[model samples]
Target: MAQKLKKNTAIALGNFLSQFKAEGNTKNPDVLNNNLFYDDFTDLIALSQSHNGWFTPEQVYFAIRSWAEALTEANLNEWLSRYDFSNVQPKTVGLILAGNIPLVGFHDFLSVLISGHKVMVKLSSNDQKLLPFLAKYMISVQPELEESITFVEGKLENFDAVIATGSNNTARYFEYYFKDKPSIIRKNRNSVAVLDGNETKEDLIDLGEDIFRYFGLGCRNVSKLFVPKGYDFKLFFEAIYQYGDIIQYEKYANNYDYNKAVFLMSLFPLLDNEFLTLKEDTSYASPISSVFYEFYDDLENVKERLKNDEEMIQCVVSNNLIENSIPFGQTQQPKLWDYADNVDTLTFLNKI
Candidate 1:
């Protein structure tokens, strides 16, 4: 029964997602105007920015299209096929979501439900609207799901386990609070890129998406770079120059101006490309509108360093320079199975 419900639910989600494709002007006839979801979706795209300044229509649409591609029956089945659910007992799993990016916590919501558990979600205030709207659509498609999904506004209670994502500070609070419960508490982590100075212009341009998408708010965004000594920034800066218009956004421009001023006041040298700034630093988490970089003498030593610091890194992007690193452009486009912090939520849920 759980398998059937989840499979049908994936189809329903896919159908709903099919309406937002970039290459097509088509809407699913079955999902007519009377359903009110389509109209609401249109309104979401229009109002997302008003709700959260960073939730621009383009970012929201990209998120929608990415989910649409992920929710297909084949992908869902392939992801779920590895798990054994016959002995599972349904438990209420509580979620404390992060609002760094649109629908960032949707995967956790999906994991709880598809694993035959009830989900009680505490939506991040910055991203409160869209997921619940989609949850309504899912419930409409599968009435059984209504009993399995709950959105909580206050304290998360009456749950067997918890999954929470937040910064290093909030994580400390979560850990002490939920210490008694079986929980997955995610703390601050950042992604980095390794460059050998031989990358083509197209590769560097694509790498811009890894840096600037969602305005660099996501953990998957490449916040740092590892470059060889004396690596020239000319071609790399030229390639990413196309994204210079990003400075036009007030919030981003404000950050750029503020962070640049802070750096200059400290007398730190920087490589400025008008829109994005590159600073020489060893940290993994860089502020918005800036990417910190470190010089590496040997790829072997850097790989070992990353291995030792794996907990602080979410992903590594490169042209296969390091084994297991993600591609240059695809950091944010994670597969459903690419669990954050390398924690397997499904396996954890099944165990509990």
Candidate 2:
């Protein structure tokens, strides 16, 4: 079964890499175009807008490819060689995918398959398209894997282990139902950036991707910024203004306008562009508030405070001031080695 899984992984990697060449023929000029699941990508911009916010289809395609390549035979074999999965059964794992962002559940899906476990995935209604499409393509590439993957529309029971992702509110329900089972239940988490006064204009512009990508919906998206007391917000705002075209979406524009009006009614101060709203807040989960940044006087003091607020912070974006942090734009592009919640996912699955 391990050898078979390795063959399936290799085939899946080949199918995914083929997409890079296919992208040229699938171009559209409209930014607000829709990218349906089964069809070739059209209206790249619109397809991106349909997700959470506006990101180019090229960006989304490359991101997916990056993830797929990480699951290749070479990498998987190296990881498995170091870990013992001899006692792990091949048909006892169930994965409940999160639909908050495009292909958000791919990592969990890949983890289960490469670790010698059958995955019964419950697709999020909001994102029912992409994963199944990829699954179909994968099965085509390696017909033997057809028996290992199943996409179910209803509840699953008697699984030896489960990995579920949900809001902090739904996390309680997951805990109650899967308590006796070996599980990885993920609650809410948000990403943040730590900015010092020394950041270049280019750095701030790149930082914009962390905040505005997918309209700040993904867990990796930066919903808040921690800036030094004397830091200038204008420079930061100007740097990201190139993405102003995202407001062309009537829905996104409506959100920006509505949030701006609410702030005005409440006499709250803010900075605005055609597509995004910026405010001063400590919260990392912003509903309609596109970009919320807060000022801090000291970096050391803020780091200490963050330790107490770890649940709210996922990745910290910084250039030089914060040690052991990712760069301004690298938050969404996690390496294969970086596990969610710092958990050893393969080991956890092996134990189950």
Candidate 3:
């Protein structure tokens, strides 16, 4: 397979994805095969939440828009340019995808093919529809892609390598099973934000988006906060109040009520803003509708701790407080080059 063909196909796929946005779906007259695929995609967006309660049209649109923004010709070229794909001997890469958020496995699927390999994908039950649809659309753009993509319903076999993502427990199983093959087994990781009491209300509001987008389902969502020792809750609560309507959603309301009850039952003191709860906890992972927080006395200590616990973190949000940290509200809008878990997927695929 010529890598350029795959890259151009990806750029075309990006254009197709770009049509569906949070504002609304607007068919691009220039895109290929709108007659066949556009209406079906819109229907999928409208009904996604019925199949999976968390997949509200807004969230699905957000996921599609993220990929749309990412697969531009310029962005794809920059991300793929660092590696040499000239002599890549194609291999079949088996993928065990996770469904935590919409199209969570797309990067892996894209990596396998764009690096001159075939992919056999096993879709997560929660997210089975979106990727396959796009795969078909891409194949429509270029007939050659039909031979390179496969979706498996049974045990994954006939592949030289595998990539799997799941909880820590599943990671163990993936390790033991794929031990014979060169593989990348990903486990759970969460994002966190560090606050220095100087962040403006605008910054905190954007941080609210980082926290509430996707109902806090994505690994990129900020689930914990590191705040200065004397930080006040007044501004933080006020800034995030825009998302208060999130409690109106039944699923999120249930989580808010349940998690709050559990915290109260455990006698843990919490700072509540009615819709969201803030608990003083050291752990990085926080339940839905609740964000765990730790008070820090020194910025350097927080930095050192994050360095030591790097494996457990996916993204760190700070306004230049931490080196290499992502800016507030932009976690969900990661660039094409931003590899998940900081594992360079493209490089790994090239080597295999």
Pick the TM-score winner. 3
List runs of model 1 lying over 4 Å from the truth.
Answer: 21-25, 31-34
- Backbone clashes for every candidate come to 0, 7, 0
TM-score of each: 0.97, 0.86, 0.99
Q: Tens digit of lDDT per residue, candidate 3, span 69-169?
A: 99999999899889998778999999999998899999999999999899999999999899999999989988888899999999999999999999989
| Model 2 lDDT per residue over 65-158, tens place | 6665666667656655667767776766888888766778887887787678888999887676667766666665557778888888889765
Give the top-scoring candidate (lDDT). 3
* Tens-digit per-residue lDDT, 1-352, candidate 1: 4677777777678778778754543567785232568877878777999999999888888898899888888888788889998788999999999998999999999899888899999999999998998898888777889989999999998999999999999999999999999999999999999999999999999999999999999999999999998999899999999889899899999999999999999999999987888999989999999999999899999999999999999999999999999988999888889999999999999988
The global C-alpha lDDT for each of the candidates, from Candidate 1 onward, is 0.90, 0.72, 0.93
Q: What is the total number of backbone clashes in candidate 2?
A: 7
The Cα RMSD of model 1 versus the native structure comes to: 1.3
Name the runs in model 3 displaced over 4 angstroms: none
